[model samples]
Target chain A: MAALDRSLLVVIVDVNPAMWTAEAAGEHAPFVPIIRHLCMFINAFRALDGGNRLAIVACHAGKPTMLIRADEELDRSLHTVLDTALVLVLLATPDDPAQYNSVMNCIFAAQRAAIMIDCFAIRTSSTFMQQAAHMTGGVYVEPTAQQELGLAQLLITLALPDRACRALLRQPKAHDVDFRAACFLTNQLLDRAYVCSVCLSIFHHGDIIECPACRSRFPPPPRLARKRAKRAVAPAHGGPVIGGAHAAAAGAGSSAPRPAL
Target chain B: MADGRDARDARVSPLITFLVGQRRGRLGRLYANPWTCEAVVRALPPVARHYALRLVALGDTGDGATFAPATLEGWSLAHDAHQAALQWLLDLSIIERAEQPGALRLNAAFREQCGSLLCGLRPPAPKPPNKHTPSADELDAHAAAQWDALLYCVIHPSEWSDSTGYDMPAALLEPAGLIAARRVRARADGDDDDGDGGDDVDDDDGAETIEVWAMSKRGATFVLQDLSAQAWHILQVYIGDDERKLAFLLELAHMDFGHGYELRDEHRPLIAELHHLGIVHVRDAAKSKSFYPTRLAAAIVSSGDISPGGSARGRAIVESNLRVYVYTSSRAWTAILALFLRLRTLLPNAVVASITRERIQRAMREHGLSAEAIIAFLTRNAHEQVRRRPAEERDKALTVFEQIRLWERELERFTAKEAYYLSDFDTLALFDAELAHALASGTHLWHRREPGNARLCKLVLHEREDVIAEARARIKEFKRSAGLA
Candidate 1:
């Protein structure tokens, strides 16, 4: 029998109560209408084929609230799971940097597995989401022109089709993506940053004292000993002596070590 | 996925399949009713259902009635993925090519009815289910008794013993091709198995021939089919060529199961036949005010997909030790289990049985059930709990199925078949021509180019009269084509 392209749509609905309930202050679209559109879109996806499977993750307050399957184990499963998986993120809130690594991990996992990751940024356009959609060969749509009015139609036309038909689809023009990592401690996007060698944590500050995520000290302990040696030499020679740690730290931060050859 | 490969699915109701074969006018008329639309929607393939659900809602009278086949609604799906679904819709007349080349139009009758349905207009609501209504179990027993007694007439023909129950449903059995008349010689001993269905008749003079009704080959296979298929097969026979009756049956499939509905005048005769077949239950078949669709009726239609072997309902759990727990109370189901299962303990609702090698061999040798059928029966009926179990535990359960197959292989040597052997060929050229004809026609079971002499060859053809007739013509045609006149 011919193998069917059985789509596995993972719809991560932004049910963040913070975003949905922000009516007076923030201009977020009504929750009910978005949910209704989502439901119709889900129905449309199911209509596409009989064997298609879907997982809806309701992210309440930017945390996976309920329904089915843990998101934590998804990256591991991506290797074994269906190739036709499409993770559609419907983001309403601003970027939650705490979940950046996880989101990025999932995006890369999806990319590696050849799974498409479509992002519909409702309220705020996320740089990570844009990059994710761009990398994974999926459409990134931030339909900010008319919030509620053509949401359903936009979703069906743009994101409903899989990667094969998507080539022909008139997708929402993707803006420039910031292929930059955010600091775990500062939560600020950075072009260049220091990464802890042990924990792989990003640090943008001058000299890394300690890793914020894994709490592993980033060579500052060795720097203190090097400072003591410099101080001991300074007293003997009464002259300025540069610490070896400074030269070592600069060369050590980058991913790979230089070969002598 | 054509999940129906295991079971002859009621997915496209045998009724719908029949209607599809009829004239477009009759099929369109059938689609006129909303209930028929509802039934068709249930039976539609998932992809096709998806399009119908959207398009039918858009099928209003005025503007935007037609949809472009190449646009978002149709074209949004992957190109190769749903072409089959689109074609299926066209075949069923749910959608058709409009005047323009690329445009598609929903069937007018189907759309109108489906539109009314989408607008929430429905047939009279089933009266709120009564608290005092007979329990589902009780109804099962009632249906079982009525249905089994009818089938019992087939299995243990009442003529042989004093176990007289329902009259020989020869009207049903004969017409349905479940049983056929065969004239047998009434010997003094009368110990033949075929002698039981005593439709014995004295032919004019001294007792020369006795016409006995025996089970047909179709009837033998019918027994192996699960309940849903058996029910549909009967309906297929019952609702032969009657478009109006078939329409009513589709409408009936839409009705609530277990709830009694008022039987209209038009449906009275149909209800009588259905009641006799234990599909629908009426207080009195003579004058019925209301008829309740039995579980059998519900099983045939309401169940999403009905396979020939069985529904993969996962009603039974197979343990590592080969013990089986079947969660059903139906006597008919138990009767099937008795074929291969070593029934250990029979509870009120569950049957605890063992998959013994002896029982498996017996079921194979006596009942002619294949190892694959037995394994499929177990797999399809695998308990939900078994699916939920850990991989190793599930694998353990799987090994039990493997054992049954292994045992069957161990015991198997040669199987018998009924076929006609043709021998006597003038030359090798003639023999090769006939062999090619039979093989191409699928009637050639076995053939030998030369049994003894190079001139003569042995060939076996299927014994079925229709197949033999067609094979003979094909063989002659091949001879003529080869210029071996």
Candidate 2:
């Protein structure tokens, strides 16, 4: 018999009030139903193994905080329990730009820990969340409105297995990953961008004399050269298209990049 | 006590054996206590614990209808895990077949307690005063000291005799069969013939034999196991057939580490037992004082992790050349290492030892230590040097580990069993009939010759008692009918 594989699962919930209220008015239910489904999924995960642990983190507009830290709630004092996390489940919609840094910090931490960050985009597709999931070798699924009833099923079928079980079972793959980067200054997704050499921060426009992030001053682009570069890169519709063809089709009307502030 | 078979079967975990021996009524009463229920749930194997949790959750949701056999079969895809979980639950009397066919139900009291636990409705015990509460480190120190003293009493009784001013619970040790009072003295001048090196025998002559204490084989095995496992084994030995002590120990297993619980009147004797076993430490021992559960007590029912105190001090640096460096000055630990390793040198803070085939075999054949237990001990106590090694380099020690296991397996290769070798029948037909009966009953071990023209057969162990008896009765009838009675 194989040895028992202990695992820790971190469930990150996007408790955005406005999105849930809008969904509550629509066909999708409010936070209560979603929470119920999440609770069922958590119980299922816990049932996988006696040593398996579950932690719940809620992301509000201000800062992401751990709603239920497994170590504290279960009173686990073992060092093994504290050292590693196996999976991170993010139930999210479109998030506020202010929480970008904090959410990214969580993603990078999970990445460094070798944790799979499974993203379940409930209402709207989050490009940042997709990137996080893709980079971490986790499954990213944005279920349509008709498939909302199968949220719990999706969690069990797609994200329940640990790395060991994933070795034998066929895993869900993210077909089209949005590689678009958000401008550090405006926190806006940019289709065509210029990156700062020192800090590697992306910018929406390259006309500035000094880099906004690192203040690395460079000679301004020649006026005639800037116009030629703009005409060469601009699409026929004069609109910035983010992501690949699949993403553009899924987010047809919402594909326009936010104007630079 | 009966034979080697009984002794070998006794190697199963004492906790499981004790739980299996419990009566349904006693088990129900034990489970009625929330603490005992929680401990039992936590002590179950991983698969069994998951099954219990799922059942408890179902009970909370009032889903009794789904517990039918047909529906429950879909619970897990792994058939082995499902079967093992069900068997364990049945053995512990946690669940039983219902009056209706194809249905199962949890014991009423167990179901209620488990439901309460899952729903987080268990009422917390009254809080003790914050003052005088011990820190985690202090508790660890007390636990380690108390445990070491107990082990010293068993492993090195000579050293135990030199220590004074501390109660050693010698009487408890005697009853647990861990230590026995014996006589020891230096060899006399006139009796100097060398025969065998009997370590426990008194070699003195024409003089009074000084009484001393020595450990038994069971005591040797006890010292080598981890602290939590040792506590359980000791409790099983001390409790014997008493169900109340088992219940109390289970309740103690549920107590939170580093927290003080009120010392009720009924808890006095149990607390004293735990104190003697080094599972808990009482501050004042007064009637109304509170008792703190040490790391040992709290971790007794934990499935995977050992106590924090032991984990910190269990570091043993093992080299590929079979040399070992244990970083501790504790006498109890040294005594344990001496059982399976050739001690070379003892420094102020470390002890150097080497693993040898003879020592390992002696531990397995004489002391009843299993290969799995030894492997688990070494793996748990692996030092930082070994732990930090790259994955490819870690396989270097695998050869040594395999050798130790092979030595142990060699000792267990031949097992003697009690069986009846049947022969000498007047007719071949009678022998054939008897052999057929034995085979049909599933008690046939082997046959010396074919039943066609010979009359030799052997029957070994049977799963049920009635199978052998029924076969014997059938053989007697056949003999009478053949006029051979």
Candidate 3:
């Protein structure tokens, strides 16, 4: 037999608590069909190449568990031959901002390892998933309510294409990312957040006597809070030109008592 | 080596066409079955499989079969192997041309079946009966004993009488071309020369005759093939042109390795035959209600990863220095290596060996082993350690194969050919003209030139009398026209 140019595919199935039990969401998330779709998609993927190796991983409450990995002999030896490795994430829950840094770190590590991360979300595309897909140059597919009925078809059609075939095919383009950083204090998505002078701890509001994170002492907030609050509010509703002007003036005025980190 | 491989391909390619390309009407339903689909995929080339799989994933959509060929990039329609790959998919009916000119669509049945199979809709194999069933290891041992006994009987029948374990029917061996029988003039002369021929006689013709038995040419090459290939050949021999039986054999690959399926009235005869062939484990062909598919059965449609019977395990580490370390207790592994390698040490469950030139040459001469076959076997069974090595270091391992190839070539000292030599040319122009004519017809072999002369003095052409005679007539006409007659 000729030595085939084999590739490795890692499929991560996300079964987070929010996926099945829909307390806030209206409908029961057709678990059987989704599983059916995933299985069909994997079947189609495996069919595409005889030599292509695959591993399945289930991520639920805590750490991810590898459900199955074929041919353990190729475990780490795969890294060198792992040039064609692709990591696919089937995400159901929306991104939790608390785990944003960890997710991004994971994405960065995947990037450094040169593995592509493709995401197929249930209904809405999560922000972290979108970024991961975008950074790795993989398709991020979010089926519409109508398309979700034929999720198996969509998953197979869009997500099964390898790196070379994906280049030639029409894929679901990544949408415009929010690019906003979440505040560490409230875990809320924010366009602009107040940063502590000492610890650089982010928050939605600026009314604080001391840095909560670093315990750095500061003068009472009445004078500093009033000015920082106005500067932050004026730019969000204003035009880009006005926002730039406001930001520049605030930076110029902030030379009074800025703490060195 | 190259000739041997091409010949084997000539034998196997048609088997693919035969297995997969059945009655078209029956094929749609066959495609709807996952087992059939699995078997079909195994028959296709790697590239065509990729293309078929991609198109299958594209789905029928009901909007119209997708315009897929247009979406595919970097394809050249004019004389490309990629074109052949596309044609193969079309031939297999995995995909077909749509209403649009270049559009291709997936077979609807194939697509739906792939979905449900992956979706876990297929029922699991039934559990074992209350009676004891053979374990996987026991099955392997049984298969090995059966296969080795059959092979030993065919290769050397002097040691074993009819009472031993494997009484592989001679009827089965003849059709496979493993053993051949011929009636020679039964001379009442020297008995010493009958060392290789078995004296199995048929007195049905009322003539005093002894049937001489020997391994055929196909058998020489057949002996060197791995277990999967050998099993497939055996099955092909069993399932000749019977389409129903061919389809039935494909089911074994899809069946669970150790599970048993109850045999129906129609399937009983086939299962009994498969039992003798070591494909299925049927303890009592008449009394047993069900038959178990052995690992050899898996090889009927197995891809490379499938560890078929006793053969497909990758326990050997073939290094750059031509050293082989086999970590297998199976005699099959050591015996195959012994065909080409010079053994140095034999520890328990392991063997140390080196590939020496003389052994390879001897195997080439005696066992009809080819360099390509040896190299292919080594790489196919190579440990993951070889796969993990750096690319530069990998080249070193490759060089070892190249050395083996060179050694094979080194044995070819000269080639003999039949040709007609034409000489004594009067002019450079006439010599060149004759050379051009011969070259155009592809009968010209070579021309000789003296050290001091620029003009060709002699030309050698192929030994085709008709072509040579035609050339003679043309030369006569030319000579008369040029006033040299």
Candidate 4:
């Protein structure tokens, strides 16, 4: 088993109302079924002796909060969710007003909290997942399917053992992980984006390529466009802004605010 | 103690504190207070944190070496070697060699310390024992008595056996002011009540049993439980370093004092039980001639191969070797150190005195001091300031690569200064041949041909006297063959 197998895992679920509602509409894993699967997986993890531990966080739109099952409720908690079978249908029904309200409250709170957190646009969004997995020694997987619980099975087979035991067995290769991350500003994935050299905030389009945090403009790579601008702009220092990619972007018609760290 | 104080005053970085504490078992205590090593602390070295965390995890075991090295290597301890960790535990008196070499054994003191710490951090497993469950109060009392008895034995193990006529003072035991057990005689005045005549006296047979005042099993068990894991560890480590103390501890195991009523040492039964707990080592005492302190004893008190010499603990022990050289300075070390204070030499930090074999043996034979007790005194106070080069430099200073080169260079210079035989050779070819031969024979330094002679070349080296002798002999041989001498 790899060290990850022996390490304690902490899962922070994005329980944002808007996000989960979108996911429930078949865009991602539906909230009720996803949660049911998560609870079962957590139970399975907790069953491990000596080396395994699990904790959960429900990240609502407004507030990211712990969803730690009460120690006393552990036996009934996960099992109850698992036994429900058609949990999504029950949760989606309009009859149970209280459950719907409580679930919505949790989702809104998590989303609000998550948005308030420092947001940064990422050209390649792999860092976020990589960091979470690295920190807790758990695999980070965001599933597109709400109906299937494939991730849980993957965890059971691959990520359950400790690093030591993992060394002896075949492990899921690091390369297999999707390294892409969604941009903080637009929440869209970008291929190549401008970044603040100081705070390393990525941007799609902005007036200044210079880092606002440090007031240091990124030196643009030399090119035909920059050379032409250099002659036309008269080098902004004692005259006009120098011909550079940053200067050109500032002059361009694109109107997107740069992302902040 | 000075080193510890200095570190505190310096406000040593948390990493350093952790490292120092790692050697001394202080970090384990700190972590017990719910002070977690925060992830964001910039001062903390990632590498050090990794090792410290692994050590803490390993310490959680019922036995100190609970996890194998291979198991740990996969975890956060990917960088460290198994031997390096084993060595540290050995230094801390947490792990040691079993009866056989290469086999790992856990010291009881380490087990208790780790167990309690881990238990405190995380609640104990909810599973109840399969055996009879005692009330909470009963458990507490049992633990207390066991600790107390162990402490008593640590302070005085001889009281467990009768072979040694001397009885250790009860006050020496921690949780002070306990009384020692001794046989009391029936009062002669009792004769006045029952005897009809001076020659005739009738007594109840039960008086013999009532005459002896001894510690009860419950009391012994409580005493052992009361002892702090640290102190118990010190005693465990102390006994192993010295041959005599080890034998005494083994003897306690053989006598089955735990089962019998006659207490030899007030703490003997407790120590004997500790041996079974794997804190101390005692082989089949009933059949064996004597017992020896396990690796646990040597590790807790003494500073040797456990941590490297340059490490804090090793350095401390090395420095303290002068006035009083204790193999260990544990409580046991202090007790032994006090036994042979020829004269007090007080330094600002450490106390110095000479604890001799004769003095220790005397304490054993006359004072009924158990071998483990004496070794503890030695280990706890071993001189920490031996005047030696640092461990790193000692080996690096004369590394094979540099030493050999330097020696060759020095010899070359000495040969250059002495003008020996090379000045006599007339031809460069002859000179080169002669120089090669001399160099091969380990004789020549520098050679240059002179304008006159045919057989020899101008040679320079520091030691001219020896070179001249050899040159003359060569010349003579040449003359005999060529008739040119």
TM-score of each: 0.56, 0.60, 0.66, 0.32
- Per residue, candidate 1 scores C-alpha lDDT tens digits across B211-284 of 66665555545565656666766776677777667777766655666687777887876776676666677776
**Candidate with maximal lDDT:** 3
Note the DockQ of each predicted structure.
0.05, 0.09, 0.24, 0.03
Which candidate's TM-score is highest? 3
> DockQ order of candidates, best first?
3, 2, 1, 4
Chain A TM-score across all models, in listed order: 0.71, 0.75, 0.73, 0.46
Root mean square deviation (Cα) for candidate 3? 8.7
Residue lDDT tens for model 2, A1-261: 101455678787877676766876895565565566566567556544345677778877667788877766344543344433555555655755555556667767767767777888887778767777776767888877655664554565567666544443445656766656566678786665554444455566765667666677756555565544432222112112222322332233211222232
Candidate 3 C-alpha lDDT tens digits along A144-191: 777777776777666766566455445665656544555666778766
Model 1's CAPRI class? incorrect
Determine the TM-score of chain B of model 1.
0.66
Task: Give the DockQ-based CAPRI class for model 4.
Answer: incorrect
lDDT of 4 by residue, B387-466 (tens): 25566643342242243334334434543243453455534555565566577667666666654654445665435566
User: Compared with the true structure, what per-residue lDDT tens digits does model 1 show for residues A69-121?
Assistant: 53454435643554367888998877877777787787777777888988888
Rank by TM-score (best first): 3, 2, 1, 4
lDDT of 1 at B456: 65
Q: Which candidate is the best by DockQ?
A: 3
Please identify model 1 stretches exceeding 4 Å from their true place. Answer: A1-119, A122-124, A128-180, A220-261, B1-19, B32-64, B67-83, B101-103, B112-130, B134-136, B139-175, B181-205, B208-214, B237-485
Residue A83 lDDT in model 1?
A: 39
